[model samples]
Target: MAATKGSLSINSENIFPIIKKWLYSDHDIFFRELISNGCDAITKLKKLSLIGEYEFKDDEESELKVQVIANAKDKTLTFIDNGIGMTAEEIDEYINQIAFSGAEAFLEQYKDKTNEDQIIGHFGLGFYSAFMVADRVTIESLSYKEGSKAVKWECENGLEFSMDDCDKTDRGTKITLYLNDDSLEFANEFKAREIIHKYCSFMPVEIFLSNPNAEPEYDTIPESEVTDKDTVIETIVEEAKTEEKENEDGTKEVVEVSPATTKAKILKRPKSISNPVPLWTKHPNECTEEEYRQFYHEVFMDYKEPLFWIHLNMDYPFNLKGILYFPKINTEFESVEGVIKLYNNQVFIADNIKEVIPEFLMVLKGVIDCPDLPLNVSRSALQNDGFVKKISDYITKKVADKLSGMCKTDKENYEKYWDDISPFIKYGCLKDEKFCEKMSDYVLFKNIDDKFLTFKECLEKNKEAHENTIFYTTDPVQQSQYINMYRNENIDVVILKDAIDQPFITQLEQKNENVKFVRIDAELTNTFKEEVNEDELKEMTDKLTEAFKKALNRDTLDVKVEKMKDSSISSMITLSEESRRMQDMMKMYGMAGMDPSMFGGAGETLVLNSNNNLVKYIIDNPEGENTDLICKQLYDLAMISHTPLNPESMTAFIERSNKILEIITK
Candidate 1:
């Protein structure tokens, strides 16, 4: 045939520049686009073969694979795929037309034959993405049909093109890119491998990267051991070897040191960078825990083993397969941000796609491969559609079901992992209402006794003591005193240490109207008090309130005198649960500078134990010289117990304690 030359079948001359600059967000994405198209071609061939339309010869290269050959010296990168090659007329129809997807067209034509084959390309524009890095591109393809001649198509800057019959004999397409000066890095083998691993690590087709300019390497294996996919260079035989050795008893012995290899063949096949069939694609029962952990480590690079994981395999509503890992996150050290890789037909699209992965599940490290996702043009983001919401809802439901199921069936392991996974569950509850409702029953709280208890179990255990109220401690070390008081009274206090727990409990309160959460030091309960005469209690409270107010020089200070069972306890600070929550809300919104008094009844109170010697002395002698010093000392001590003392107050407290000690020595 004569050489044919013409401008590309596009209306505008500026289309190439537009595709190079504005079509894709990242230049590296060109690799994914071109590789995905190759995969689609191979997939179409498999479907045709499956339906018996295409026959595979026993001696031919029947293994479906994509080979990426990067030639740094030549400044070229080539993609060769042993798939269904296109005819000259087919190339003109698919390649000449812009935005016309060849995969979509083939799927349309073979709809009746194909059942579950995944076509990666939705728009033919992926081919043009090559212009993002290449100055010129060429394609050599031979149609799989009996007498179709090989066609070679070439274009400069994706504009004017030339087509002619070529000497190619292979029954597949080979695309070569003459990379531009600025994009020459892609021609480096290392860079090519990096790009392939980033986006095509899990592609449906086995992708192998090679540097054609590098020295060729080969391995010799037994002919019987060679697979159909291996490229054989030669076949040879090896002679057996024997060695003479002295036995333990000084007798000479002849032993075969190596066995003779028969029909050995030299083969060259680069290892595939892609795991075509990933762990997520398999049924849960067919997978092992070790495989799941290995997948987590490989995908997220998190060596710290996950607390547990949920393998989602669904087919009825929509095709979705994934493994969501509850990674063991040290919230104190590492960021709680988890990686959820989103994929289409095993090709990674993005990470942490909120449209498909529920926002709450972002703290989970996993991979979701859902070909049914409604991806937009670039496949970098998802289109705003209700189907995406359904996917997100399904993921949230799966997580909740996993947690609730574990709590029911694997109670021991559930409690074992409660500490590591509670923050995720709490954050999920805070973000998703349905998830919160589903997980409420399974949420476990760890008490001071190192025991895990459900909210219902805790409430029922303390029903007679503190009805419908849950007491929690933020810092077990700092609030050990308060916790001791609860323990002395035989009441359980759950530890809510994570920052997420603050909002989580608020949500819990809103959900259960009858329930309320209180910090351990929020108030002095009557359970810790010894019964005293009403008149005597009133007299002591009045005396102490006046004495403390006068001595501390703060008339507005709210003071209470409680005769405690633990007489050694001198003073304690009590802030109402309602007031503490108000303060916390203010801090969260950056209104912490505002006065706590702005919230009505939000002021803190100083509770003096009348049974203590310091309190009795101050009550009896309101005018005593040491009484003033004792008042300041007691207030500072109480402040330290409640929270960390400010620098100035901490300094003052130290000096006052030294002075008190001097007085005691005198």
Candidate 2:
């Protein structure tokens, strides 16, 4: 055929620029798009071979693969695939026409005869992505059909193209990209390798990256080390090494301990950079614990071992296979951005796509490959479709099922991983209602005794002490005083230290209306108080409150006097649960500037133990010389126990403590 030139067939004159802007914001994605087109070509050829429509010549390359070559000296990046190529007419029909997909056409023609699970390109715009980074693009292709002639096509600025017959005799296709000034970095060998590793690490076909301008690197290996998938450049022999050794009984002998010594051959083995088959594609029974760990490490590059993993494999309703790893995260769950890589037919689409991955699952490291994903034109995001919701719901159900199953069958390991995995489960509960319902029974709480128990177990165990009330401590060390009081009464208190626990407990309370979560310092229940005459107790409280108010010099201070069974306790602080929750909600919503006391009397009440010696002395000598110092010291001590004391208050307490020490010494 003679050389022919024409403009690209498209409706809009500025389509190319629109494609450059809208197809993908990341220009480097052109690498993924072009390579995906190559994979699709190979997949089409494989379908043809399977149905006997095409035959591979004995001398041709049998193993299908994609090769990427970066030539820095020429400022060009090339992609070569030894799969089905295109004819002249086919190129005109597919390449000349914008938004026309060759892969989709081939699949339609062979719809009944072939399985289209491995086809990666569906949008038909993948080939045009090359224009995003290249100044010019060229295509050289020779079809697999017999008697087909090789064709060459070139396009510059994506507006006009020229086609002609070429002398090249390659069986497949070769695409060369002339890197633009801004995209010159893609031509660097290291940069090319990095891009390929990012997108093609789990492609169905093996992908190899090379630098043609650099010196060829050769490695020597034995002949037996070469597999059918390896490419051998040359073979060489190995010299044998013989050493004389003494036997155990004192006899000296020369033995051939090295098996391949005399007959070994050095063979060159070329390795691909990608794994054609990832761990998720296999059946769960065929995988081991070590293999799961290895796959997690390889994909996530996280050295900390995962707590556990859920292998999702379903064929009916929709084909979805994945491995969701519960990573051992070091930071807060809200701040964590878990890497849940989404894939379509083993081709990476994006990470943490909320349309296909439940919002809560984003805090997990895993891979989900659904060949039936409904991707938009760019193949970068999911189209608004109901199918995507089914996938997300399926993943959420699978995770909830796995956790509940583990709690039922493997109680020990479930408890062992509960601390690290609780935040994730709690987050899921807060975000997803169905997941919360499914995981409600499996939630574990760690008590002050360092033992784990479920909500039901906690309620049942503490029914006699505080019915339907779950008392928890936020800071175990700082709240140890109140914890000891509860411990003295044999009342159980669970630890809820994480910020997530605030909303989580609230959710639990809403779900189970009868259940309540109270902070340990929220109230001094009757269980901790001694039975005394009401009139006498009321008179004592009135006198003590007046005396404390006069000494502390604060007229607005909330004071409560209680005769406690623990006489050693002098004073403590208590805040109403409603007031504290309101304050916490305000802070959570970023309204820290608002006065929390406006919602309720959020200011804590100073609880004075009437049985303590200090309270007795203060009530007896309200106007004594040292009464003011002792009352202020007791109030500071209570403040320190409730929360950290302010710097100024701490200094005053230190000075008052020294004065008391001086009085004691005198």
Residue pairs clashing, model 2: none
- Clashes by residue pair, model 1: none
Using all chains and alpha carbons, the TM-scores for the candidates as numbered come to 0.92, 0.93
lDDT of 1 at 570: 96
User: Which candidate number would show the highest TM-score if scored against the true structure?
Assistant: 2
Against the true structure, candidate 2 has what lDDT? 0.87
Off by over 4 Å in 2: 11-19, 57-62, 222-268, 332-334
State each model's C-alpha RMSD to the native: 3.2, 2.9
Worst 10 residues of 1 by lDDT: 10-19
Q: Model 1 over residues 15-54: C-alpha lDDT tens digits?
A: 4334678788899998999899889888888788788888
Write model 2 residue lDDT over 124-152, tens digit each, in one string.
78888898888799999999888999999
Per-candidate Cα lDDT values, in order, are: 0.87, 0.87
